[model samples]
Target chain A: MNWKRYERASDLNGALTLLDRAEGTGRVIAGGTDLVLQLGQRQKSAELLVDVTGIDELRGLCASGAWIRIGAAVTHREAAASGLLREEAAVLAEGCGMVGSPQIRNIATLMGNVITAQPAADAAVPLTALGAELRVVSAAGERWVPLEEAYRGVGESAIDATREVATEIRFRRPGAGAKTRFFRLARRKALALPVLNGAVCLWRDGDAGRIREARIALGPVAARPFRARQAEACLTSDRITAALLEEAARLAAGEATPRTSLIRGSEEYRRAMIRLYLTRTLWEMLDIG
Target chain B: MDHGVKIRMKVNGQWREAETTPDRLLIDLLREEFGFTGTKKGCGEGECGACTVILNGRPLLACLIPAAKAEGADILTVEGLTPEQGLHPIQQAFQDEGAVQCGYCTPGMVMTAKALIDENPSPTEAEIKRAISGNICRCTGYTKIVAAIVRGAALLRGEAATTPAGVDRERVPQLPPVGPG
Candidate 1:
């Protein structure tokens, strides 16, 4: 709410320069669903808001080479409605669709969701599980940061947003036998944050065959969305039995470090949910019990 | 420092400009500056869809958007839906279906429907539910509201709508303007 001026960047270079000039006092305004809310709460302040909606480069969903690219400016609505994502990475599409409301999804950007780095941020759950990478750009240069290592804690990111902008979000386009699932339970069907959310990506050898690779990510279970490394290690074999799922769920439950929140849920409840959701997601994706 | 920033946008269909503060939200700008009080503010945290307005062809929560960032954008509020030709089809349908209880959430609901019906003239019942999921109505349940939207979609496609058996559709009451010129 303390912004001194507003400027719409005509292009990426102009946006970087404005951010560079504002030093730490500038905030990039994308969909403004998140940025504006933070500003309204006075949780975040700025001297300048470099509206990046004008930049053509930071928009749209595209598949390049081996990765599917999502521009920073791509809204939740756009991501949810994307036919390409629905076909290739339907989990991401489903995740984005479950954001807030039609109004929120229409303006809230996926990049904003990822940058906010909320442990339970819906978009980040799938991005982390699917091994998404962010393309960070600044006046200095550009770099690629994996979604897993990008954050240090809730609302904290290794990437300095004031100095750099998230230009794109991309992940590998999974091939045959690969499936991903995202599951979350909120108080209501809409307009409520997930009490606990989980996303899993796994691949089988063939139709009704052995497991190849697996990745699991849980949110609000820690300072940031985390990879259930031990659980994933359990899933890296052809023998994916119900016992294996049980073991992996137990591991994931141990992986979470949830807290007692008045709004969310208790640490014990969160742990139980991590196990249940992990079991359900694995069975649902693999078409088992 | 001067917080006044220039914003040029198309409201309804006409181009307009306003010098507002960087912190001035679209809901405030529309209600205070332009007198578009039809847009209400509820649950300012973007949970309730009462502040919804179409910005650049998408329904957005105005309370969460700064007016200065809306520059060059084409916005449509509930007022824009009304033409010299009378109430917009959706508004008429809402009235016909008795969808207005408190009338607080009507404007935002109608704008959200406009956004959906414009893109998909024949939206499925499921799609309609998904599209309006952001809007919350405390009275009359959402059944009538959803039906009104379905009928509104039909009306937009120029189809004749017959009142369901035992259902009486009312017209907007003709009342004189109250107070202030």
Candidate 2:
């Protein structure tokens, strides 16, 4: 409620300029679903709200060569409905489709979810598994930062919203022989935070019929989106087998460090779910019974 | 202190202008400035869809949107659905199907249904449930609300009332008033 001015930026430069002029008191407002709530609770304060939803260059969602770029203004609903994303990055599409609800999805931008930096953010979990990068811009210039490096802590993003704008999220499009899956266990289907959520991206060596690379991401289990490096290492260069899947799932469960949350669940329960969901996701990807 | 910003938006087919503060939520502007009280504010947060309204052809939580964001945009509220004389078909269907219990969630539910039917004229039952998942109806347990949306879709499609057996107008009994006469 302390916001004194609202300015809508027409382009990327304009947005950066507006933020530069605010002298670190201007915050970028895209969807405003999370930022508005934070501002209302006095969790955050801003002298000026530079609305970036109108920035033209920041609204692109297309594939360039090998990368798929999602603009900062791309809402969950738009990402969920994108045919390219559905075909190439279905895990992200599924994650976005499962966010708050249809109404929230229509306005909550993907970058906003990422910037909010909640460990269990639906979109952020999938983006982590996909190894996405953020394109950040400021008056000085622009730089591409890995998605994992963008988080400072729980509910904190490294990118200063008052001074910088996360222009877009870019990730390489999963090529042929690669598959991804996202799994979420929540108290209810909608309007509830996830008890445990995970995402996996696997690339198979077509000729050898072996796993070439794997990325397993889980959340609300750590301070940030957790990458199960041990589990991923176990799966890499390994043949698809029931025993290997079990070992990977177990490793993933071992890697998680979930805390007992009154809203989520007991730590033990979430750990068990990590193993269960990982196993299910791997089995489905490998076409196992 | 900063004074205020001038905003102009098309609300319910009428272009109106208003001076609003930067922090003013769209829901407050709709209710206080435009007198569109039909869009209730059950939960100020986005979890509840009681403040839902269609902005620029998409159904969004008005409580989460800043009034300045609505500048130059087109908005449709529950009040916008009414015709010159009669209730909109969606509202009529809700009444016919007995979807109104405490009547608090009705406006938001109706607006959500309007957006759904506008895009998908023949949405499946699952789609209907998914579309209104954001709306919380403590009364009627959502059975009657779901049935109302189904009937509303039919009415919008220009089909005859295919009221299901459970919500059949004849089958619903009239009860005595709660308060003493």
Candidate 3:
């Protein structure tokens, strides 16, 4: 009912020790944008909070090697401004920039979004499209999990991030001519949660520029962020064309299992918008915008 | 509900400490404990930027932030904007450009604008809009508020004060188009 202790973890060991001890009674405060609200609303019954914002290893966004490693604690604002993310991962950078606002983005982390496991989380949608891998760590040691396996349900996760820290999310930079885009349809332009959102990424190859591989992710249309495998398959046969985009849109919407909600929209509208936005996202990627 | 966390931080150039429950919000810490109340608490949730503050050089919502997170960080609020001589350029520009109406959102607006101008000496109109999109002001309809921030940038740059900086009348470049949500 009340947080009995607020322990500041200066490093990863200190954080692991405290978390390992608190067990289920502790909540980790990375950006504190979500946890602080949850704590006040009594949504999380943590008697102790282990602040991991100070952990050195849990910070930084580096693109040095094969993969671009984004620290779990890196705030959305930081990601939006980073030259590396802007270049190699502009979809993620733009998505992060769209989250809540400049104020909220200044403190919300990519890992928090990934771990929130929400269907339409701005950061998670792009990370899912990029096939990002999450390094979930605890005192028990380390394990890497694909972003998909981390989700248990909406706002729920199979990974015990309370017991384990999400150290980083990493992915290889897309190759040349590869297109990545994240698009969302919200009620208002600013500070509105997505009514529906999706991200698309495709690898371009051959002199004719055929789509060699593709990944498509859409949210709030399923329990977790739904990957449109059938839609992605629509692109595999040939280079992009009007017919291909139409087929992909149709398949992507058909792949969705959206629930009818009074706030978001009807199930029919969601499916229709998915088709529309999917086309625009593809058009934008092809520079036909 | 009594025994609490002992926390310390520098707020508006003053090093201060406060004892509170682990669930204490940073907005309360500044207003109640530190007594620098220029920052307003509009929404306890992160939805409203009325509770914005600069922590360690980044603007974050104080209401959504726990007090413990302020430890060892340099925080800037509207109270710290004055340097003994006169009002901060931002406050001055806001007044000159008629940015304030109801005045409830002024402090938070000033802080957010301060962060924007500090980071970008002269942001384009679109950049200015993106910077303050987090903060909401109902009274000014945002035109004067945007104009004031542009003027503030000019004042900070020691440029010609005749016209507001960054094209105040210019329509901001459109952001990425959205779909029906």
**Highest TM-score against the true fold, candidate:** 2
Best by lDDT: 2
Which stretches in model 1 have alpha-carbon errors above 4 Å? B1-3, B162-181
Q: After superposing candidate 3, which stretches have Cα over 4 Å from the reference?
A: A287-289, B164-181
Candidate 2 residue pairs in clash (backbone atoms < 3 Å): none
Q: Give the TM-score of candidate 2.
A: 0.97
Candidate 3 Cα RMSD (Å): 7.6
Query: Which is the better candidate, 1 or 3, if ranked by DockQ?
Result: 1
DockQ of 2: 0.81
Off by over 4 Å in 2: B164-181
What are the per-residue Cα lDDT tens digits for candidate 1 across A97-149?
88888788887899989888788888889889889999999888999999988
Clashing pairs in 3: none
1 against 2, candidate with superior lDDT: 2
Q: Please give the range of 10 consecutive residues that has the lowest summed lDDT in model 1 chain A.
A: A32-41
lDDT of 2 by residue, A125-241 (tens): 999999999999888888999999989999999999999999999999998788999999998887789999988999987734889899999988999999999999999855678
TM-score of chain B alone in model 3: 0.87
Provide the TM-score of the second chain in candidate 1. 0.88
